[model samples]
Target: MDPWLTLAVVAGMVLAGTLLLNAIGARVKAEPLIAIVRAGLQLAALVVILKLVFTSMWLVLGWLFVMIVVAIVTSTKRIGWSREVLAAAGTAISVSAIVTVGVIVVTGITGRDPQHLLAIGGILIGNVMSITSVTAKRLREHLQESRDEIEGMLALGATPRQAAARFRGLSVSHALIPTIDSTSTTGLVTLPGAFVGALFAGSDPMDAGLFQLVVLGSILFGGAIAGTVLTQLLGAPKVLPQPPREAEEETAES
Candidate 1:
């Protein structure tokens, strides 16, 4: 396919989707086109950065660090920023990513390729970031919604953790459902990006399948760890969780 033709096709598809959404009265119209444009720009930049990153081990590590920092900041923004929330989000994401990646490295699965390491690490970190944010947000919302029940439990001599245990479990489970469902239905329902990319890069079909399995397992492991750690850290607050605007104002006041 010609490069210009490819670009035209993508633009047309995005425009069609945007118009369809508008016709149906959906809230998303311009965003699809905007997102496709943004993705194209980002991919172009990433191709240049990746060439340099693939050449140097230090660059690989640095890129991974940048990704982790971005993940932490993004998660914090989603869940509300307090000193405590920042610390918890950072810890959950970092710990889960490190442990998951470390196991893969030590087992010699990714071999001595820095590019591979960065790719796997980035995927795990991104997934963990999403899971941690969802878990924290869900836990906070549940806690706030059940404030009276929690307070009653507290008054009945239940510890904070005890009072919030049910919500914590619920939050972790809710946060993990998408990962669980996707993993369960991988080939039939969805072709994961990692798998498709591996095949596109000329990897053997078996190798690509194995790689996808590893990627999926890493995501599940990291997500579980992240959700559990984050909920444990944020679940039993002294006061109930506030909405994002209120939390932002409170943070500003403090």
Candidate 2:
């Protein structure tokens, strides 16, 4: 396939999809077009930069740090930009990513190659970002919805953590559902991109399957860790501030 021709075909397909979506009242507002343009530009730049950076371990680590920062910014938008939120999400993502990637490197499952590091680390960080965002958002929503019950428990002399435990559990569980489902349905319901890409590169089927399993397992583990951390950080004190003493007295009187 001619590269230029393939590019033109892809651009045409994107335009047609955008037009059809607009005609159907989808109201996406040119996002798809913008995404296509951005993807092309970013990939082009990355190709040039990565070739040089891949020769040095420090350069590769720097690139991974940049990716984590980007993930943090993206997650901060979905979650709030509060200090606690940033700390929780960043710590969760960084820790989970390091642990998972470290295990892979240590076990010799994936070598110390910069290309492999970037690919696997990118996926892990992205997954952790998503899980953190979802956990934060859902935990906040749950706390809001269960305000009365939570307050009642607080009024009965329960600590904020105790009061919000149930809702926290619910939020973390909801956030983990996607990862769990993907892992459960790996070969049956979905052919993951990693597996397919490996096969396309002429890897043995068993090798591809094993590699895919490792990726899936890392994602699931990282997501669970991120979700749990986010939920734990979003206790009642973070979401529901304590009322003034006067207000508490008035409520008690009522």
lDDT of 1: 0.90
Query: Please, what is the whole-model Cα lDDT of each candidate in the order they appear?
Result: 0.90, 0.84
Q: Give the TM-scores of the predictions, in the order they appear.
A: 0.88, 0.86
lDDT of 1 by residue, 106-158 (tens): 99876559868987998899889999989998898898778889989999999
Note the residue pairs that clash in candidate 1: none
* Error at 178, model 2, angstroms: 1.8
Best by lDDT: 1
lDDT of 1 at 30: 92
For all predictions, the C-alpha RMSD in Å is 3.4, 5.6
Per-residue alpha-carbon lDDT of candidate 2 for residues 199-241, written as tens digits (9 for 90 to 100): 9999899988888888898898888777777777666563484
> How many Å off is the CA of 91 in candidate 1?
1.1
Clashes of 2: 0
Candidate 1 lDDT for residue 180: 98
